[model samples]
Target: MSSSFERYQKRRLISSYFSVVLSIALVLFLLGLLGLLVLNAKKVSDHFKEQVVLTIYLKDTAKEVEVKQMEKSLAMADYVKSIEYVSKEQAAESMKAENGEDFMEFLGFNPLLNSIDVHIKADYVTEEQLKLIADETTSKSFVDEVRYDNDLVTLMNNNVKKISFWILVISGLFTVIAVLLINSSIRLSVYSKRFTIKTMQMVGATKKFIRRPFVWKSVRLGIIGAVVALIGMAVVLYYIDKTFPELEFLKNQILIASLFLGVFAMGIVITWISTFIATQRFLNLKTDQLYY
Candidate 1:
């Protein structure tokens, strides 16, 4: 009977340790998911920004020299990323490719106009900057009009802003919720060892002395959980990259690795802090309070 009792106690201690580790791992996993969302958000925003193009149409009567001069001016613009010159012939060919056989037959003559397609840097694709670019282009003598989807640009910018704002808000909220959840879990785990803590207290152990072992144990658990979370995050990112190679920007190996490391560090920090606080709280609790 004495041997059986000792075995049972050993099993219970092992189970309790495993439970603490598992709970910390789960919290780390949640933190990794949040980090992944933030990394991908930036990738998505850059993809949209890259699609914003500004088109400059040449005046019908404008001479070739004048058109070339206008194109040079646009190419020199600070916001311009690259300038693609679409001559009358190239424009006609592009229209033909899109419209098929019926397009040329219906038009009788090539109605395509000469234009310069400008790809602007992502940061400059804002309402105010776009309007300024348009005003400057139209002021040129050879430029008939600056053509871009004004409404679409405005809408895209507004949507990007809203998305960014919400991402930040959601991330912050999730972080707070995660901290609270992990703190509660740690507190409960420590409470299960209340008898051991009380025994140490009765033996005249200093609070700091009693805390040292628990604090070191918590730190080890945090590190293990962080490592597991990082591995899971890396697997997810690998699959995403394989499935959508077009999103190469998201797969920036160095940046992604750095972000993964940072998240892992953050997970360890959060776990340690929460566990320390929870243990401290339980240590300060009255004996009667430990019953609850």
Candidate 2:
């Protein structure tokens, strides 16, 4: 009967340890996924910013020399990243490509105007900066008007700001929640060993000596959990990249590696803190409290 009782106790302890390990793995997985989302959000936002272009339409009667001068002025602008000159013929070809070859036949002569497409630097894509650029460009003698999708730009900026703010808020919330979960899980794991701790305490074991092994164990478990989480995150990201190759830009190897390192470090810190706190609480429990 005593042998059976001991076997049951041993099995329960093993089961509890595995459960705690699994819980730690899950928490670390969530942390890793959050890091990935934050990292890719910046990349995705920059891609949209890069796509924003300012179109400068030349006056119909403007001289070629004047247009050339205007283009040179724009090239010197601080915000200008690159400028592509689309002549009348190229504009016509672009229209044909979009609306089919025969569609341009209805318009007798090519009504498309020659224009310059300007890609602005990411840092200067704000509405105020764009408005300043538009004012400067339209003031040119050869420029008929400078136009861009203002509403779309505004929406994009707003969305980027909102999303970034919310990501930060959500990340903080998740961190707090993760700490609580880890604390609870570690506390439970240590609670099951209360009798052992009490016995050591009675044997005049120093608190540091009693806590050292548990702390080391927790750190090892944390590292293992973090590694598993990173593997899982990599698999998910790999599948996403395979399914949507257009997002290949988000698969920045260096950034992903940095995120992995961050997540692993967070896991180790959280586990160590949680374990230390939980062990301290258990160590203070009275002899009668150990029974509960």
| Top candidate when judged by lDDT against the true structure | 2
lDDT of 1 by residue, 1-292 (tens): 9999999989987787677667666766777777777777866776678678889888678898887776687678778878998887888777768877446577777676788899888788888888998998788787888887778888888888898899889889987887776667667667778778877987899888888787777777767767877777777777877887767745477877777787677666766787678667777888888777
Which lDDT values do the candidates have, in the order given?
Answer: 0.77, 0.85
Error of 2 at 115 (Å): 1.4
- Pairs clashing within candidate 1: none
Model 2 CA deviation exceeding 4 Å by range = 1-11, 36-43, 60-73, 233-258
lDDT of 2 by residue, 1-292 (tens): 9999999999997887787778888998997788788878876787678789999998789898887887797789888888999998898887778977755578688777889999998788888999998998788777888898889888999999999999999999998998898878888888877888889999999989899888888888888878888888888888888886756834578888888898889778988998899889888999998777
How far does residue 139 in candidate 1 sit from its true spot (Å)?
A: 3.1
Give the least accurate 10-residue stretch of model 1, judged by summed lDDT: 244-253
Model 1 misplacement above 4 A: 1-19, 32-46, 96-101, 237-262, 286-289
> Clash number for every model?
0, 0
